[model samples]
Target: MNIDKPHAGNKFFLSEISFLGYVVTRGGLRPDLQKVDAVRDAPTPTSLTHVRAFLGFASYYRRFIKGFAAIARPLTNLLRKDQPLTCDGECERTFSTLKEALASAPILVRPDHGKPFILITEWQSEAISAILAQQGKDGREHVVEYASRTIPDERKNDSAPQGECYAVVWGIQHFHPYLYGQKFLLVTDHEPLLALKKLTNYTGMIGRWAVRLQEYDFDIVDRKAEKHGNADGLTRLHRPGKVPKGEEITSWKEPKQSEGLEYGQVAILPRT
Candidate 1:
């Protein structure tokens, strides 16, 4: 596996270079401009196979594309056996949007193992998304990666609390590789979720998700949805076109109180 396979994109002793279809430099990792240009220039797919091929290429750089799964969900729906392969208005709009996103995609920095991470997950009416990041030496928060997925139709009717709980579990698992073995902050706009650590197996869905999270080392923080615009990108892909009824978020209090708003904010929880 030496220069014996140079075409395979092997490199050595270079601070900045293109490796496996991405640009690597001090700034961060980004998709090769030529590849991005090809996607932007490609025409809309007219068949199932063509759609799959296009998605395969776009997925290669999904790490740099936020909410990629939700954005591509429309096209994926067309791949269903019971569904027709025709590209509709929704599919066409999604295809162009994905290309535009890739064209202007952000540069993602690699994680710093020595530093702590901040994970933000949000449920925006129709989808769930999260961003795993860390503050770099330069004092700016750098993104390790972005994740998001469309909410299934059956689950759309779920209660807001249920959705919020799911986001915490889903987000942690999605970014488990970077989050495991380190203490991190799990930011959420839902204050009720702030009590996540207090739940047990006796609780319903939230409790179950809590059990799954016991092995991880992290704390949940409450940030109002207005200020939560950071990880709110992906959910906008679905046009629920509605906002949650305004609910005031209370400031998190020190843990170990009995006010028990049932699902109010809790600053820190200790293992009993």
Candidate 2:
């Protein structure tokens, strides 16, 4: 795009670099300490405008914080159109926690397709969350990425089974780019959801969701709820406010008749 000169941000022959607020290195993406310091030393938000400004900035690094939606819920509530601007004890606490979370955020490593992946998904009435991890050379699992979001308002009252099914579906969709053809372990805390693997001709909300799974390869595993406490405590993470570049959030039921896929071929769902 430049006829004579390149952008000032361009650099070559560097061992590491900071790009779009994150530090890029062979190990993976880490938060820039300078940016983290700003968040850590930020003063209390005394006005509605201040609150919004802070969230807008923090959301840029939302990928670093696991349960961002839950932690920011109280603060976001204040953003309601006609709500009064008040920072209660909970809001004050949440704001502090956010600052601390950024300061202590872990370095999220880059995804290596060569290694096997383990995806853990759990859902509650208020939210649905998932964590994608890989076994590092250290023989310990390290998180690759985190994704979570509050369920749509109208579906908040869905039964436990329905919510759990929704979680699995959304989790897969959110990480589709990395998971499309790869065989990975799909972990779920809801025992009822494990049954989807054997379901045949099932026709309902859950059935339609199962049909989407035809696009990927995975084996479902069960985990206990108590084991998922960290994710549950905030009720959990992702790029948070914005979709990652190159991701296409598509409707569930529509299959692209054109554009043949490279990995697994899509199969038409039979009528129930």
Candidate 3:
């Protein structure tokens, strides 16, 4: 390791250092104070170039923002082809929100390999999001990372339930390196996931997703939607149009249980 200020001094010690727009301390990693202030104090972007520059700077610390992609959607849209460069009301609001989110961003800790993780997901008609957190020694959950994205045009027509399932699959895959070998709890408000392992009649995307999920070690637990605030906030922020209508799947019922193993646990699935 190369140390700065390598003068004739015998040794130098420092408590912490700021590197690449992040502060490193014994406690955890946090966005550098100066960078946070820069984002907060930045003027509302007036053109596409300005928007992109601000986004480029802000994107560096996006993991600190709970739903960054959703929050910045309006501003990003300005950069799309044929879109106007003007900062509309939505764009201004998004810019402000991003600054606020960054200014108040939390200090995230390194993932402790010894501890188990918790994965929570949310899905709406427009976007899907997930949060990875772990219980700290103080018994409170701390966020490891957040992920969210707008639904592409090809999937805009998926039902809400399917979207939820998609969120799970996407979330798991996004954090696969963190979760591959560990046992983690998968929490969601969607009840269909509780019966996911036993459903024999699922078709299309949901079926393919379920098959893929069987390879992971996890337990699916249902939590009230209100409790999933982080991911819920992400999905709700960037909904762009009227939700897909008449795509509801009303026939999925809770599967009957067999033996001690419930359908929600990760167990060997019969080959399709």
- Top-TM-score candidate index: 3
How many Å off is the CA of 257 in candidate 2? 60
Instruction: Report every candidate's CA lDDT.
Output: 0.74, 0.74, 0.73
For residue 111, model 3's alpha carbon misses the true position, in angstroms, by 0.3
- Count of clashing residue pairs in every prediction: 0, 0, 0
Candidate 1 residue-wise lDDT, 100-144, digit = tens:
999998889877888899999988566888899888878877888
Model 2: weakest 10-residue lDDT segment is 261-270
Model 2 misplaced regions, further than 4 Å: 1-14, 82-85, 233-272
Candidate 2 yields a Cα-based lDDT of 0.74
- Which digits, one per residue and each the tens of the lDDT, describe model 3 over residues 177-254? 999988998989998788877768657888888888888889889988778787781122212132234211122233
Candidate 1: lDDT over CA atoms?
0.74
Cα miss at 234, model 2 (Å)?
A: 24
RMSD of every prediction:
17.2, 16.1, 17.2
True-structure lDDT of candidate 3 = 0.73
Model 2 error, position 161 (Å): 1.1
Clashing pairs in 1: none
Q: TM-score order of candidates, best first?
A: 3, 2, 1
Would you estimate the TM-scores of all the predictions? 0.76, 0.77, 0.78
Write one digit per residue (lDDT tens) for candidate 2, span 1-272.
Answer: 58478778777789889877889998888888887787677665544545666788777777777877777887787766545334456777888998998899898988999987888887876677888888899997788877788778888988999888888888888888888888999888788877897889769988888888887889998878788664560111132334334332222244367843222111222233
